[model samples]
Target: DQQVKQNSPSLSVQEGRISILNCDYTNSMFDYFLWYKKYPAEGPTFLISISSIKDKNEDGRFTVFLNKSAKHLSLHIVPSQPGDSAVYFCAARDIPGGGNKLTFGTGTQLKVEL
Candidate 1:
């Protein structure tokens, strides 16, 4: 079964506006959350992350929020630019499981329109 899911398959935002991507998980064993941005032919690159203990984490124009009780998380990009358009995947880590395997969501395609 797919433990992680991105409810929205795609999203469109205007350049210079805020872009919000959402994710939901069915597994409660996840301890860490991460967001990855992938371009056409390139591997997904780390964007921002948050620990389950904390509700929010911010880096530059990106922010990640986690709701442990709800098993939900979101990535926010402020003043989104065209360069930020890509497929974003939400991943969760089961730190207690020993191996560092990450469970990834299906991914959400974000398009920034100019």
Candidate 2:
């Protein structure tokens, strides 16, 4: 079973607009959530994260919100830029996997139209 899931495979947004990517989890025990952005061949870089203890966290134009009760999380990108076009991956770290391996979603490709 996939611990994390991105319902939308792709999303397109206008330049300078806000893009919201949603993710859901099945395991209620999951405690940590993270979001990563990738550009083509490069590896995904950590964009934002939200701890189970907190409801939300923000960094620059990126924000992550976590709802432990609902087992849902979301990443919001404000003023989406053309350069922000890339694949986004939602990840979670929990027990039973051991060694802190991140469980990831298939990925959502975001396109910023100018």
Candidate 3:
């Protein structure tokens, strides 16, 4: 397989709470991990990324943790807001020669309720 998978198609969370999204992968050769957020009719925007050498990466209100041993990863958003409602994609790519290419998941639609 090309690798990378986000099993959830949607998620719902109340505003001001934490939203946790899960992802998994099969290929062991993937070295670069990225999470992207998208709005309807728009392209995904880079959120956070991690290398095979690290297990965690954080940016502002978002945090991503990777588990190399389990071949899994997750995204966490604190104080989830209504504005956070959108599609989230968990993506992966191999840094065969050092580049920002990627393979994306089906995506998950997160609805933040007020």
Better of 1 and 2 by lDDT: 1
23-85: candidate 2 lDDT, tens digit per residue: 999977677889999998898998888888899999999999898878889999999999999
* Candidate 2, run of 10 with poorest lDDT: 93-102
22-79, model 1: which lDDT tens digit per residue?
9999889898889999999999999998999999999999999999989999999998
Query: What TM-score does model 1 achieve against the real structure?
Result: 0.97
- Model 3: lDDT of residue 35: 89
RMSD of 3: 1.7
**In candidate 1, how many Å is residue 63 off?**
0.3
Clashes of 3: 0
TM-score of 3: 0.92
Using TM-score as the measure, the top candidate is: 1
lDDT of 3 by residue, 50-72 (tens): 88789999899999999999999
Stretches > 4 Å off in candidate 3 = 97-100
Error of 2 at 71 (Å): 1.0
Candidate scoring better on lDDT of 2 and 3: 2
The CA lDDT at 76 in model 3 is 97
